[model samples]
Target: MRTHGWRGQPPSDADEARARILTATRTRLSEAGTTSTSEVAELIGVTRQTVYRYFPTTGDLLNAAAADAVIGLEAQLIKHVVEHLARTGGDAADAAVEIVAYVYEHLRDDPALNRLMAPGRISSTVAGLTTPSAIALGRDWLAHFPVDWEAVGLVGEAQAEFVEHLLRTLQSFVVDPGEPARSGAELRAYLQRWLAPALRR
Candidate 1:
């Protein structure tokens, strides 16, 4: 195999290379506001091609690096959703809107989560959010809801599909966010009008 100035000796195997790329990516994200493929490559003494070989794209690299941060964001989101459910008697659709609105209203206050909501390359960002791990994490977040998903007709595949839908909704809010992003009462009302119907069906 060939190498591209990756320290004294290049990674001995593909696994090490991928790990190094992830490490480099996390480091780059910390030092710079964004994680660029070329920056990760240079930081780790490898060529951009090497980084791409492991990560496929900058979005993939960024998503990989931010996976841990995702969990933290989920924790806060889950807490807020659960609390909302407790206060409001846990309607499934309303809980869904709560998750979306909570992030919209508060994502900026938390630096880590604020950064995560910034959106990325459409393909990779969607791919990243829909990965098995991400999906499972979504389910985990939902599982904490005080409502009975089964009683609401969201069991088995229905529940899993709901998780995916929620992810897409979150993506849209953070990405395009309409001409002006909706939050607080306006956002909640908008979600109740449009998003809640989908959940009820």
Candidate 2:
């Protein structure tokens, strides 16, 4: 919260400006379940119009911030996957199931992520996930998974399709997640039962 605006200095470039806005948006989400372009503008000592220039819509702002939060989550998932396999002696499908389950949990539990869909933003959140940037992010994340996607006949374009499929599934869970919402173990089992068999070619 610099009063002088961006620590009393303008962003070095457009990239820096966008980065600052995203950082501000994420901070606002951490502090409050929701944030607005004005709020981010105020935080960064910029105009809402400036923020809007970079993120034309609220969805764009929230999604960019959430994506930033997700970058650090990859390391957490890496560890969680290793431990889950060690404990459950799971296979590739199982690992994939755990990954999905873990992500659902992360989305459910992480304030920054969960809050992106705050109140009136549900439609925007859904819209955000479908954006090309969001799809690319999901695809890149899955591409780094340790699971043997080949065994599931998910090589080449099929792999890309599967990644999109997985992203959509996660999007469904995020949007609805059912009436009572399943537990992590229950989620894992659910994915294992349905998603696993589908993957086995």
Candidate 3:
């Protein structure tokens, strides 16, 4: 019967409880660079049992938080690309390079994303991106861009392939970053030269 999930105020429903837990998780991650069910429960004035009822494990909690964070961040990235292309008069290829570079740079520095994408946790990250949910998210986001996929002969299954390729490339860079890491202008230039051409097709 214990309902309070935050301080003295209880969430109105299960959905609200889950939201509060996620919010607490994000806050804890920002402050401590990590979080635990116990810490989240303490922050929310809930029992560890309550947290476990919602998220069975720390990984589950982290994955959910990371997914939420990525959705927001990706939207922002898309917005940035749209605005940048509009101002600069860049084509779809330019947008592709920009998007890849932006994600590569930001993902490296994103603490929550880094936690979800840690070495042993890569399969989880891969599955998240390759699953139907991820594909739908990617497709929806890309559809908003000014890119003329049809003109480039990148419609239907080709479009899906392009999205998956972009994600896989980003994941590769995030995980290994290669023997000689590229950064700053160098990385941008590399993505422009390589990734841009593929998108143009």
Note the Cα lDDT for every prediction shown.
0.73, 0.76, 0.81
Error of 1 at 13 (Å): 27
Please give, for residues 1-201, the per-residue lDDT of candidate 1 as tens digits.
Answer: 457688877888888887778777666665665668888788888888877777788877776666645555677878788888788776889998988788556544443344555644444654566677777877877787787888888888888888888777776775566766554888899889988987687
Error of 2 at 112 (Å): 1.2
Off by over 4 Å in 1: 1-68, 104-109, 117-123
Instruction: Count clashing residue pairs per candidate.
Output: 0, 0, 0
| Model 1, global lDDT | 0.73
List residue ranges in candidate 3 displaced over 4 A: 127-136, 199-201
Residue pair clashes in candidate 1:
none
Query: What is candidate 3's lDDT per residue for 97-195, written digit by digit as tens?
Result: 777788777677666777766888877776666676676777787888888878887788888887888787777787678678886688878888888
Error of 2 at 66 (Å): 3.6
Candidate 2 on 84-180: residue-level lDDT in tens? 7778777667766777788778777776677556778767877676677776766666655566667768677776676666667788898889989
TM per candidate: 0.60, 0.64, 0.82
Best by lDDT: 3
- Model 2: CA > 4 A from native: 1-67
For candidate 3, the lDDT comes to 0.81
Q: Model 3, poorest ten-residue lDDT window?
A: 126-135
Clashes of 3: 0
Provide the lDDT at 187 for model 3: 80
